[model samples]
Target: MDKIVQFVQKSEHNATAVAIFGAIGVAVVALKALSFLKVLVDVFLRSGINLKKYGAGRGGWA
Candidate 1:
């Protein structure tokens, strides 16, 4: 933690770059987490459309 503070205080440009990249990294991780949660919800809490109703694999005029 102290090292990080020292590094940031070393230069304004370095601090800015670090802040930008950190925010981007945080956003990417958050998006990935949300996507994973959505997948879990889809798999366990929601049902997909029934393909049988559309005649998918019923040998109906492929």
Candidate 2:
């Protein structure tokens, strides 16, 4: 246990930096995924889109 503690003490700075940046990266990815899921639910599912009329008017993108 003492050897493990000593090793951790030795690498404290590098460990702290890695942990902080890793947490930030994880938070950013989570926020992006949440944003994408919100758009999927709000725009794709909740909004009513008349596909046939839209495709007929807009020329073959159905």
lDDT tens digits, residue span 1-62, model 1: 99999999999998999999999999999999999999999999998898888898979775
Candidate 2 residues 7-51, lDDT tens each?
557887866876798899999999999999998999878967676
Model 1 stretches with alpha carbons more than 4 Å out: 54-62
Task: Give all TM-scores, in the order shown.
Answer: 0.72, 0.57
Best by lDDT: 1
Q: Model 1 residue 7 lDDT?
A: 94
Which lDDT values do the candidates have, in the order given? 0.95, 0.81
Worst 10 residues of 1 by lDDT: 53-62
- Model 1: how far residue 52 lies from native, Å: 3.6
